[model samples]
Target: AQSVAQPEDQVNVAEGNPLTVKCTYSVSGNPYLFWYVQYPNRGLQFLLKYITGDNLVKGSYGFEAEFNKSQTSFHLKKPSALVSDSALYFCAVRDFWSGGYNKLIFGAGTRLAVHP
Candidate 1:
């Protein structure tokens, strides 16, 4: 089984400042990690993914994440935050189940607040 943990329930930042949401995971094999953002009452929107290649991967809306294998962590980061960036962020890991199905296990989620 695969599992993920998001230690922070919420992260607050002022507009135009860098923000980070932390995540950690544990999986059997090589991990497939991902990040998604959700607006109020809306489904999650894909942010970025780290399947292979460089440790750092960029994604939609100027968001990026660092995949640290040793630490088993994939933390989301942005250089500058926008007031609109305030949303709920989720960390996920793809798992291959015994039934031959691939599924995503999401973290508890972190709420980001960017005050103007």
Candidate 2:
């Protein structure tokens, strides 16, 4: 089955420091990977996605992710963390079967806490 795992329950980092949210996925064929951020009382905002080319893909809000095919990993990264960046992060995958009415499967979810 195609799925994603976010090993960390939460990640704490000081403001202005780099931040990373780890994610690993398993899929039968080429996977469509996506990163989304959710703030308090707000819907998830799309950060980025890895579709075909470019191992390194950049996304919204000064965030980016590296697609490691060998490791089957797609980790979200940011050079500097902000208090506003402290939110819930989710790693998701869409398989070939995920079309029409199919939905995106997400990880358990990771909380990012940024300390000022």
20 Cα displacement, candidate 2 (Å): 0.5
lDDT string, candidate 2, 20-77, tens digits: 9999999878889999999999999999999899999999999999999999999999
What lDDT does model 2 reach?
Answer: 0.93
Candidate 2 weakest ten by summed lDDT: 95-104
Please give the CA lDDT of all the candidate structures: 0.94, 0.93
Q: Model 1 off-target regions past 4 Å?
A: 98-101
The TM-score, computed over Cα atoms with residue i paired to residue i, of candidate 1 is 0.95
TM-score per candidate, chains pooled: 0.95, 0.95
| lDDT per residue as tens, model 1, 12-62 | 999999999999999988888999999999999999999899999999999
Clashing pairs in 2: none
